[model samples]
Target: MAGFDIGEKWPFALAAILMGATFFIHLVAGGRQAVRPLLADSGTVPLDARMTLYYAWHVVSIWLAFATLIFFLAAFRPEFEAIAWANGVMAAAFGILAVVVTVLKRLPAAMLPQWVLFLPVAGLAIWGAIR
Candidate 1:
């Protein structure tokens, strides 16, 4: 926090914080409301503790890793432009693909809102990387 001036990079920092919060919210609340029910009714062994653990672990790990990485990039924006660009491109592509998939699948209304959350993250990352 010493070398990083929050005022100078508030947009990226705000974006990072929003992204982190969104990831956390999705991992917990959204997962419960959406993923848990799907997983439960998938005809898989609902009582399989190991399967549940494995699934939770996979989801949490990816969510935390990506969110943490974005925070790191926000904290060190100038030094991490290449990393930012790489992540930005990936995030942007994923967002676009998710939108397309959602439309093609005619996913639930809730899904669109969830996917829309990533656009700001992608925008901020690309903005920070280029600037």
Candidate 2:
């Protein structure tokens, strides 16, 4: 029960909450707005490409859920701290990639605001890992 001290591990808990929320938002809103529309474009998009993108979207959903679980466990289990660190690094990478791609495409920040959702999760998880 060494790391079961919830009061001292609030950052990991908060990161878990944020990541869970992001997962749900991605599952519900992103599915409705982006996934469905992309799939619906059968006339313009090729079958192989559409299916590939759909598969990738599901992969993200799975990763988010897995990260949420890992961070949540890290809040109570000290051994999972390393996994949390890895997740934080990946989250930071995702955030940076989103920003770079948005800028490269000359799109408005609002159009690709994934960094907003990702960076805080990275920060919190990393903070928890060090503390």
lDDT per residue, candidate 2, 1-131, as tens digits?
Answer: 95368687788999999999999999999999999899889669889998999999999999999999999998998889899989999999999999999999999999888899799999999999888
Q: Candidate 2, which ten residues in sequence have the lowest lDDT sum?
A: 2-11
Clashing residue pairs, backbone N/CA/C < 3 A, model 1: none
Model 2: runs farther than 4 Å from truth?
Answer: none
Q: For residues 1-131, could you state the per-residue lDDT of candidate 1 as single tens digits?
A: 56556556565665677677766776788668756666666555455764776578567548646754665576565665566556656667767878888889999756656456567777876776555
Error (Å) of candidate 1 at residue 103 is 1.6
Off by over 4 Å in 1: 1-4, 38-64
Name the TM-score of candidate 2: 0.95
Model 1's alpha-carbon lDDT is 0.65
Error of 2 at 67 (Å): 0.5
Supply candidate 1's per-residue lDDT for 39. Answer: 62
Model 1 TM-score is 0.68
Residue 4 of model 1 has an lDDT of: 55
